[model samples]
Target: MPAVQETVDQVRRIDVDQYKYGFETKIESEKAPKGLSEDIVRFISSKKDEPAWMLEWRLEAYRRWLTMREPTWARVDYPKIDYQDYYYYSAPKRKPTLKSLDEVDPEILETYKKLGIPLREQEILAGVVREDGSTPSRVAVDAVFDSVSVATTFKEELKKAGVIFMPISEAIREHPDLVKKYLGSVVPVTDNFFATLNSAVFSDGSFVYVPPGVRCPMELSTYFRINERNTGQFERTLIIADKGSYVSYLEGCTAPMRDENQLHAAVVELIAHDDAEIKYSTVQNWYPGDAEGKGGIYNFVTKRGDCRGARSKISWTQVETGSAITWKYPSCILRGDNSRGEFYSIAISNGRQQVDSGTKMIHLGKNTTSRIISKGIAAGRSQNTYRGLVTAHRKASGARNFTNCDSLLVGDKCGAHTVPYLEAKNSSAVFEHEATTSKISEEMLFYCRQRGLSAEEATALVVNGFVRDVLQQLPMEFAVEAQKLISISLEGSVG
Candidate 1:
């Protein structure tokens, strides 16, 4: 018994040490007074030098947020949040405009380096870093620190392809006409409580516009890091793919460990025109607190995509492994004939983490089609829930929908639940739903152990097999990171 106890202790110690991206970046910042108010919204808009119309839009959203209440319909529990106790905005002090990557703050560069971001290679044409620190061919990156965009790489290359990729703040000023045309077209300001808040106070996020008939030259990505304490992050992302165009965008997030719970509410909207397609992927790894759930991020986000023209398509892929409480539903609206939508997700809840997430597909036009694949893994004393909806309207003749939700358990102390709502108002709509729940088989573990594999290794092998379908949907680079994160999250979860 003593030997077994000691082995368990060692496994736990390793599991607790797996949060590799929890280090803080020490940089001075300018912060707004801690609280939510009209003044704060105005201050954020002023900082960005937004136009009067944009400010009015933000104020209108704020007015709507005031009349709304924080939603409590999810199957998760956490302490109440004091909306007045957090800094609505925080940003690193502005530095002189940068002419090249070398001019970026060394501290900022070091932060990305420690996070495993290939900044040097990404800036060059070749994806390799030579001995002299110059190479080529890598994805473009926009790094967001707290509430502002710090730097964007490969912008010149993307610009040559007629792609407009920049920070949302810059987009608001430089391309106001484009921003005005599609900013709230998909997700209205009145979308939800948190989204309304984000609409009003969102500081900075990525913006991408693919020109007509052009395929993006390379993948555009963003990395968001939250460093300031007592502050909330509200970033808004807008992506538009013009007719016959294509683009793939990826986002990643992390935060420093803190004992006090922080808030993150974001809004993302994607628009795909006729014959165009958009692929959006996210790998979220926020701090999930300690074993006792003392402090972590409370992530409440709203993400939606719109297929507004015939033959348009949009897909969302996400790997969620952290956050004390997560509530998000990335949805798609198929509003044009023959449009398509897809959602692929993998959610992991360890320690005291709680996740209430899924996707929604709304079919409103003839011949629309949609598919959803979701996998949830629960370990320790955590809770994982998959809540999703699929609706076909009266005009959605010949629409088709398919949904599959699967849950895996790592220990006896965890819980997994699925809630799927399907509604079809059109008699011609075709729908299918499949769900399954399973636990790690002792026989499987025994077989792997007999092959000289450790318990953690065996568990990860099984999990990877279970989630292979969704993982394959991610891009190659993101898939590697997602796999490593899955293995680390499941470590020490099994005996």
Candidate 2:
């Protein structure tokens, strides 16, 4: 029998839920009133102790949000979300002055430890050697528990390198000038409905600024966890790479399992100056409900990058494997002559999940270049869609772009779709787009089975090969984790 057929026959023999990051921690938390109003926005601003200008900004966004409506153009279906039924802010109760990790709640610390995040500097640097006997590269982490930053590692080291890596709230207080100048510069406050909402009630997120002519010493990361029930998580992150600077940033997210659906709306913006570069990566594994998809997270996010100066570059790589309903698009605006942009993504869906994600590349200057590569895998009763856009403005002479979209389906009940848009206003502009959708080949499955591999193993192997190109774009550590997540997400999906 074919390996795929065998896998289908055995799918009903085992019933297992493979989400290991669904455990919640017990901690006392402070929460705002359960509703959205002008007063609630003011309450959030007061909680952060932001300046008057910040408060006014929030109020303006809130007023604008009242006039906006939720978008429904995506290929995803979900029940209407009552904006007033969720807690806007929730944070662990702790002292205002925290000198070290010892002051953080022990239960929260254990939760992160269980999630494999290195919040301790010593543990990150403690005798961890690479295969070549050299110390492995370190990662600076900003841990955001529910609504506030619980801890940030390697502050001193990053400061010594002339890098500013801290929570955005701290940046608002310490480096107000930088924050004021760059905040909402890439993705405006009124960019979309979710972004406008985030601008009003965003709680906490990471902020990074790399000085000119300096390269960040190590990888910078932010880990977000949602633990509170009936609460929404909204974080806003901003990164700026000054002229001749370079930085690499990573983001990861997870949520506890619950019978009720939750909301996660986030905004991320990147700015690269002249001769600068920024590399952004994401590994999103939020809770995806159960086999029947009764409850899960509604992930709506907006992420964009701006190549603002000559010869600047920006790249985005993401591995998305969770979330019951996902609507996200990470884009880049090539506004500088000779600037470059790249997007590589791997999206996997299973067990009634719905994903509609891709990227946009806008060429606004002469000699600009952009590339997009997307791989989507659908299993069980899920639907995956890739929608992308590439456009060269009228003045963008000598612009070039290439896009490729591929999809793989594991079961007859699943679906994969691709929708791409391309436009070139200048005669000198060039563009190319290619897309394909297919299932695992029966001959390949039979060969793997003949080599003594089980049906499940063979399916995983084939899926891995299908996504290898996009996986190679991730960092070494993240690539390994993403590989394992793909296999786990496809388990019991063949039937």
Candidate 3:
């Protein structure tokens, strides 16, 4: 049998509810009082030893959150989340500072190891050599466990290249000026209910700044893990690329299985200056509850990027296959002349999951261009939606946009939806949108079966082909992992 088909068959044999990342890390943790009061916010801020201004910022966001209502416009149904019933902050009990990975808690390190994260720099770099005797590309990782960053590797190496890579909490302390200038500049604290809550109580996330005229020597990545029960994980990420610089960032997330839903509300901001470029990618695989959908994550996230200088570019690529309820949109603002933005997504839902995700492109400068391609796959009584918006402002003369959304259904009980909005305020602007919905053809399945493929394997093969376009956009290693995940997510849908 072909290797790919063999892998598919192996994955199909696993139980549908056996999420690979469902194991919890047993470690003593420190947590704030249960609830969403001003006092809880103060406690979190004080725990981080944040500046008074930062505290005031959180207070302002908390005040605003009190008046704001949770959005209900998305095509999803869920029980009301009781903010006061959950712990706002949770982190492993550890020393305030660590000099190396050896000092990190063994259980936490083992957790990341099980998740296939390379925290030891020397181990990852060793034995990694090409035929020409050149070292292969390396990835600097920021491992965030629950509410705090457990470790960030390759800090000294990144500093040599004038790239600022660290935890956001450290950035606020070390580079306050930069944080103050750009934090919330793209997605403000008052952007939405989830973002506002994140701004108020977010504990830790990755921060990156690349200097002018330099390309980052390696990929930067962050891995987030939620382990504590009944606790919400709120993280904030920010990246800035100065003039003539380039950086590629990757994000990965997971959570342990539980009987009650947990909350994950995160905010990410990206800024690119003149001639700079930023590529961001995500592989989200949080636990999506059992086959009956008894427990899972409510992932409400806001991510946006800004082209702040002429000729800048920002690209987003994501593979989402988890979460019981996912409400996210990664968008871009082309604010500089000749700027460009792109979004490529592959979303797969199974086992009663609900996903509503897409992107927005806003052109505000002359000659700005944007493109969006989204593919959604639904199976096992799931609901998947693709909602997007594209607009060209009055001043955006010569602006152009192209958008394509496609959905695939694997079973009669599943559903897929597409909702796109487009607007052009200038006569010189042009926009095009295309969408399609389809299901697996019986003839195709018959052909595969005749070729010695089982029903589940045939379905996986067809689904892989359906999402090949978006898969091509991901990094090489990520694409392979995503392909296997796609097969695993659809294991029981066909049989």
> Which candidate achieves the best lDDT against the true structure?
3
**Per-residue lDDT of model 3, residues 1-495, tens digit only:** 133665586586787668888999999999998998999999999888889999999999999999999999998889999999889999899997778999899999999989878788876668566466645447899999999999998899999999999999989889989999999999999999999999999999999999999899989999999999999999999999999999999999999999899999999999999999999999999889888988999999999999999999999999999999999999999999999999999999998999999999999999999999999999999999999999999999999999999999988999999999888999999899889999888899999989998898888888888988988888777777788888888878885
List, residue by residue over 61-91, the lDDT tens digit for candidate 1. 9999999999999988988889999998888
Q: Best TM-score goes to which candidate?
A: 3
The list of candidate 1 runs beyond 4 A from truth reads 1-17, 121-123, 126-137
| Clashes per candidate (backbone, < 3 Å) | 6, 0, 0
TM-score of every candidate relative to the true structure? 0.95, 0.95, 0.97
Candidate 1 positional error at 370, Å: 0.7
Q: How far is each candidate from the true structure, as Cα RMSD in Å?
A: 4.2, 3.7, 2.5
lDDT tens readout by residue for model 2, 1-495: 123333433333444566878888999999998999999999999899899989998899999999999999999999999999999999999986478999999999999989978887876668676465645448899999999999999999999999999999889989999999999999888999999999999999999999999999989999999999988999999999999999999999999999889999999999999999999999999998898998889999999999999999999999999999999999999999999999999999999899999999999989999999999999899999999999999999999998989999887899999989888999999999889999888888889999987767788789888988888888887777777777777877765
TM-score of 1: 0.95
Please give the lDDT score for candidate 1. 0.89
